[model samples]
Target: MPAGTFTMGDSSGDKNRADGETPRHEVAISAFEIDATTVTNDAFARFVEETGYVTEAESFGFSAVFHLALAAPEADVMGPASGTPWWAGVKGADWRHPGGRDSDLDGRGDHPVVHVSWNDAVAYCEWAGRRLPTEAEWEYAARGGIDGAKYPWGDQEVDEGGWRANIFQGEFPRHNTCEDGFLTTAPVRSFAPNGYGLWQMVGNVWEWCEDWFHPSTYRRGTTAEKRTLVTDPAGPESGQSRVMRGGSYLCHLSYCNRYRNSARSQNTPDSSMGNGGFRTVALRVESQA
Candidate 1:
């Protein structure tokens, strides 16, 4: 059980971060139980086998594949790339086939599963008797026990003695030596948990939130419009993309540097691509007899 009050977001989190994380604000939340790490492949597989569940990607016949994931010879090809020409649609890019056709969970049973859509996550949560965290709840948990200091651990960047979350350890896009001992999503518990006992709050793969992304909904976060400020934002009433938090392994300091605890982004809940994934949160209820 992790319970604490934390400063939601602040400009001090990342000194050179995008405007989306600005105007750090104070947010308080009640204590709750959160999975220490993102749901794992094996865990998800069990859920499917038990309930005969099939994910959206599986039903749709394909999911989006990262450019680099297709570098292997045996890797299935993705084509008709649009927004990010590099992103290709792979027929087998579901949780079971993380890297499209060729790649497998392998020894990565503990690594957080990726390529999940919001609906998929919701289904899994329902099956587990859990639910997706509200946007406010997620922000509070990500901050861990830290209050408004910036970042899960504080304003400081990865220091010499301390290691941060599992984001891009090397240069962006090309040339990853896996300095963090992982080229992709590390084991769910690979790194230390934040003060709130939540893993991958700052990095790993982005987790889907129940909220739909609306620039007017969030007071902070990068947006050119004043209408973007949203309170207790549950995302847009109707929109193509839902909100996503906790940057992915694809995030890099040089390019998509939004791995910060408070930084937020979105994707079409119906669109299954990229390394988007999710985690489950629990609600504690007292029963009256």
Candidate 2:
């Protein structure tokens, strides 16, 4: 665990930033240990094997899989998500079958497990004696040692010399250049680690956090008179969706520019998708005392 203070949101001049990321503010984080990488298929498999736990996708009998991964026939039969047409609700698309019943982990044991929900992540964290990082903690950690940088690495171009993260390349939803040498989920350690030695903190998968989704969360925390210095803010008390940080491989600058450290998104607790996964964080026992 490493404790520190950091700026918590995007600046007004930051391009492609969403309204939710407004009112840039500073946050003080307490000491905590976050995973260097997301939980892999092997790790999640062990959890399921030992406890016989079933993922929400499995229980619901379907999940949102990327359209690019679906076969032409499957894609035709299963239309894309209403809001984001790039994703398709694939039947039997559980964690085991990432693209439906035909898909399997195969040689991707080291890849981050997908089609996981916030509830499933919570169960894994509980079983592992850890918890999800709050959105503030997640941002603080993802920023590494740098302040207000666009990525875990400095604000260099994504493919400066070569691919840094596993984000989408070329045209989105239609064609992928695969310049990063990946079409779907890359291995958990496919890229270099951030300053904190955290792998894939900004891409490959969208990590679930412990905060509730509220567009004006930061705005609500401030008054017209003055700004409040919120230490270790835990986000809203209640909401319909949970916070999801670190955009996935489906992310592209052409559309979703949420692969940045401070960028955020959300999903229902039970909504599982192929790009949704999570990492765990352990609070310092001494701090808890």
Candidate 3:
């Protein structure tokens, strides 16, 4: 948790579909530390090599494959295979083989690793002598001191000055010219950092946080709700899905603009997909309380 103060949530724009990003407010956070970027295959390889740890994706023997990245023996490839036809359950798609046994992370050592679950992320954090950030901490870091700003850089559009982060730049799931220089996952250092020196915090991958999912808590009987103004406020005690942040490259205005800083989404602990992955954060071994 790097020390900083800024408004969280959407402060200036109505340019979003996510209702949870409304009522941007000021928030003060303590000084802690976080990952400079999302974890990569190389990084995770180090953990696994040293600890012999196996990820859930590895143990389960399957990872979700995007419809476009799947091989159809004669079928309609539309969206992600997890919930859509485009996604196909591929076997042996762990860190070693991101696309099952056929694909590999050859030149993708620097790319943000995908196919991880909430459980996998937690295990990595523990092995690295760190802990995942609470939802509040994750949001604070993602804000990058922009406060109520719509993005880590600002309210400026992605094309006004060209895309600053890695996100879908073309039409929906149909065509992606890699206009932003990357089609799937850009090089981890492909973009600039936010106000707090955090890179790729807004896009690249949706990171898992140490919190549960809860939508009703954000609603305040029309006045003001305390839970909405979360301050290191860990979400619900139990939930079917865990908290995830920092939208992924799959996000697009035509589909999901979850790439925004204020934007958030979630998935079950057991679920894994091309767009669903996580990054780990640390609070300093001494800050553990």
Candidate 4:
């Protein structure tokens, strides 16, 4: 991991930019090692098998799954999330079985693990002796060394030539063209890595970060008199939800454009969904001078 300063929020007054993304500010981050790819099914399965740990979804008896991915009983019983009916709360939708009781990892060993909550991510990080990247660290890493770029690879064309990260192509929620060759989560490293050799940083799944969500966290830094150089911001002291970055396969211009490097979203720490997953980071130990 390389430590440096970078602009941290949306500088473009893009109409697609969300309100929480405004007041673009500068952030300096210390060196830290982060996983090149989001946690995969095989890695997560190993953690589960070794620790015999049960994810919150398993204990809660249900979790959010994409409505299109579920059918029959699972879909029938668990109503969709308010407004965003694309997300259905399905019984037995744990990290191991993303769709429901009937679903399994199958051949998706390399795919980024889904149906994981912030708490679940923290647990995995703890077991692995790592920690979730802070919201600032996440955005910096996602930028992949290119400052103020719209996307990780520095192109907003999205599906220009059927390349780039995995995201909704056709019509979001209603349809997915799968132009990127994936309707849902793609295998880790399925696409090109960024400038920092980080894979799937902008899409595929929303990675959990170590920060509480607040809409105006960057507003103060934007003041003309205040020093805009913030170092390792940890977000708000308290919030209803934890921060999530990188967007997901469900992202589309029709409804959501959060796949941008600066875009952010959040969910309850206990809420696990098919579009959510995470990677871990480790503090770089410095030798005494």
Each candidate's TM vs. the true structure?
A: 0.85, 0.94, 0.87, 0.94
Which sections of candidate 3 miss by over 4 Å?
1-4, 12-19, 23-26, 71-83, 220-223, 226-230, 285-289
Cα RMSD of all models vs. native, in order, equals 4.1, 2.2, 3.5, 2.0
Q: For candidate 2, what is the lDDT?
A: 0.86
Per-residue alpha-carbon lDDT of candidate 4 for residues 56-168, written as tens digits (9 for 90 to 100): 98899988888777733634347878988888788877887887888788889999999888999999999998999999999899888999888888855677665798888
Candidate 4 lDDT at 101 equals 80
Q: What is the lDDT of candidate 1?
A: 0.71
Per-residue CA lDDT of model 1 for 195-275, tens digit only, reads 767777877788888877765454534323343433343444776677788787777778776777677787887766657
Segments of candidate 2 deviating more than 4 angstroms: 15-19, 71-77, 222-225, 287-289
Q: What tens digits encode model 2's per-residue C-alpha lDDT throughout 141-254?
A: 999989888888988867997789999998887999899998989999987999999999988999999999888888784521267667889989999999999898998988
**Any idea how many clashes model 4 has?**
0
Error of 1 at 141 (Å): 0.7
User: lDDT tens string, model 3, 47-151?
Assistant: 889999877878887777665555333332233454455467776666676655666788999887788888888888888888888777887887777667777
The TM-score between candidate 2 and the true structure equals 0.94
Error of 1 at 104 (Å): 1.8
Candidate closer to the true structure by lDDT (higher is better), 1 or 4 = 4
Local error of candidate 2 at 236, Å? 0.3
Clash pairs detected, candidate 3:
1-32, 1-33, 2-32, 7-147, 67-86, 80-87, 81-87
